[model samples]
Target: MKPNKHSIDFGKEEQYLNSDKFVDQIICGDCYQVLKEMPDNFIDLVITSPPYFQQREYGGGGLGNEDNIDDYINNLATIFQQCVRVIKKTGTIVFNLGDKYLDGNLLLVPYRFAVEVQKRNPVKLINELTWIKINPTPKQNPKKLIPSTEPFFIFSKTDNYYFNKDAFLEYHDKCLNNGRKKVGNEIGKKYFELIDRSILSDEEKALARKELNETIVDVHQGKIESFRMKIRGLHALPYGGQAGGRLSQIKNKGFTIIKIYGNSMRKDIIESNVETIKGNIHPAVYPEFIVQELLKLLTKEDDIVLDPFLGSGTTAAVAQRLRRKYLGIEIHPEFVEHAKNRIRQNINNHTLDIFI
Candidate 1:
């Protein structure tokens, strides 16, 4: 059975880390202590943005408040190892780390931790996805550029990690319609002209026209947003450098068409407005949309999603909305209440459909 909607500050060690009794609970304690109680292979996804070194005042002197750079990276690496231990072999971890400036030089803190995590843990570095902040905090220093991006490192113990690619593309298909090319009424006109001009037999031209008509029908049905038909002698080779069956298809068929649903070319970068709040208990509250995207990409309904850093409980709220079980661990007491309230409000105010 699913746990209650509200967050729970874990206490009484006897009842802790029990997935059935507290599947969606937020354990309000040091993650180091909380992670120790979690069972191996318990979580399917661990997506969280931990405290960056000296960036914010995350109470309880957690990983970020260390005295030096090495200490900070070491502390985060320790958390990374623990998270890997709790996650299943098929699980995936997405840890977003922000960079900092020290002594007028940009400290590569995020990369440092990533290197250390790979060195100490038995995991593979899958992707270093960059997050471009649309509205970053204004910096008054004229000599340095404004800091606006962060890195989300995807790690997994094995290649069997669960990734929902169709669900991911479906979201960007809806979210990136404005950025995609238009499927105009004269979409297939140019292809027809190119086919007529190409050096092909009448039989080849007939085949190309048939395929072009089918492709345009797909655009009208919203199966795809656009297409590119490469007719022999009329256009360059689609696969000049790549080795695939596509090269032979152009040699034998005289034409080939590429279908793009929408935003299929956009990869490895996330863009969202910085969620800057005034007098907030948790200083840095990440954008909820980013969490939603990651959850959709990495998990399915009823899968366990863990956030060791928890912060203001963005993961828990998104997990609940997506019908995934969540386990959150936070250090501060006041932020625990803030996270619980946020999750409660999200559940009460909005209803979300499961991943299609």
Candidate 2:
């Protein structure tokens, strides 16, 4: 499967999808009906941002057109229950749902959906990712500030879900991490002085000096990028945020060390603006880079990625670019056509060697 574009005449297909032909094809069909037809343990990674409840006119009046919030939740949750059945034991689902504001108050649509799906299925909530929109839609209500965040809930049916933490770390490193830090000429000299001047027994000073010297050797030998030592009496106590391991180590051992590997920043929040592709007719589309990051974190080459609510084929495009198999189910024929054209253009824009 060396970067070939799949073509499916969705209108001519009078029968349900054959599971073997799901790879690299974007089909026009209702999600629940289509998913029910597929067998169990099919997809490797499931990712989609379904139509928001009453956010806009999707023209396909199934999931988003429910009268009340409960109806909407039930519809979405039932579909998710089907999704859970289709994914493998090690598969993961990443669902991004937007919040709706009505009658001067907010409806916790995403959170409520999270609760509903977990209650109905044999799934575990792995993580809640908060996507911060750099440019959000403006609100004319003078009484309230603008809403700029949405949630992407990640779920897994079992504990064997595939998570490439090194790839996840590399994703953040590309965005927020710099290369190895350069040390000054007097790297550990100040720590030696602080250790000697501290109110500690001679034994404590000797141990501190030994550890500091070893750390300096590690830095120079390129084992680590950089480090900072906090003396018990001189420097403020180190805070390891909520984990508090660093602070406990300082209290017990009379010193603490901060090590920077320059690999990752521990963060659940990501910043991406809403995207609108040129040929895309869908009202809402998530950013491509966000999908790429998640794909890198959760999948390997040739793994199947499914997006049930394929608006503009963002998932398909990113999957193809990354050399992964993708199957998208779009209900609207017009949106399906748009997704096809957009994905074709996306394929032509770059070769397999480089992804912009």
Candidate 3:
């Protein structure tokens, strides 16, 4: 008999802390059952790329092998609904779903799932990002355009959520491209006084003014730009105040002012040349960089990150490296073992080898 959802004990605060040791570990079982056992508003972030419908066959009742596309989407939505119960109101969910082609037609599985999920739950559809696969497996169709991109749908349990803009600022050096030229203009304005009437001498002020004008000209003229704006009077901007303005914008002159880099981060496009996972039975293993970006953006240190479709444990491994607690649920025992061993290897940095 199945255990009652409410009856599942959360114990006292001390006991809960002891049991919270379940964090950073993979529980091999059905996702629905395991998620039902978890406490409400327990997870801070949920990032996972569940198996695509009818994409692959991993023995022992793997996902993505549903009878129909609608069936598969509905099933996935049901699991995510359970995830919503455990996810905090301020939490976020980033699901990376790929599309499939049937009878020479494209099926928008990712968007379909997004709509279905929102319809069934009270979550908000926050953002829609695209993951362009630079090196995707060659398709048999030369007549049709080669498949190269996937949809990354971001959802929030509530309108207000926690987002760390600085987490994905790895390429900060070349962030201020033409996309953020308006930011450059704003920076020029903010520092106008420093160049106009600062505590510096006449000669020093003249030199500062020249430098500021040159930088602004460079920005307006579509010259190379970076996030490190050398100006005075710093003010915050949306999506990371370092830039002093918003992201990409198009001017009336038909030119796109693109901020190639931000003090906080880059654009929605995550460039990935898929790398093969060695000795992994699962057909699809999420790239570590992808998981890292999502975790950093949606979670904080020691926050609970849950992955219901824990195929090969990419999310778990990345979460461990990021120092955030992780909870993974996988139905297949073999895949579960794969995830556990992978996590162990990543954490120890020592291979499990025998010296006989």
Indicate which candidate wins on TM-score.
Answer: 2
Q: Order the candidate numbers by TM-score, best to worst.
A: 2, 1, 3
The whole-model lDDT of each prediction reads: 0.80, 0.80, 0.70
Candidate 2 on 4-23: residue-level lDDT in tens? Answer: 12212222334657556877
Between candidates 1 and 2, the one scoring higher on TM-score is 2
Better of 1 and 3 by lDDT: 1
Please provide, for model 1 over 116-138, each residue's C-alpha lDDT reduced to its tens digit, 9 standing for 90 to 100. Answer: 89999999999888888999999
Off by over 4 Å in 3: 1-21, 171-265, 350-356
TM-scores for every predicted model: 0.84, 0.86, 0.71
RMSD of each: 6.5, 6.5, 10.4
Candidate 2, residue 355: CA error in Å? 6.4
Report backbone clashes per prediction.
0, 0, 11
lDDT for model 1: 0.80
Query: Roughly what TM-score does model 1 have, to 2 decimal places?
Result: 0.84
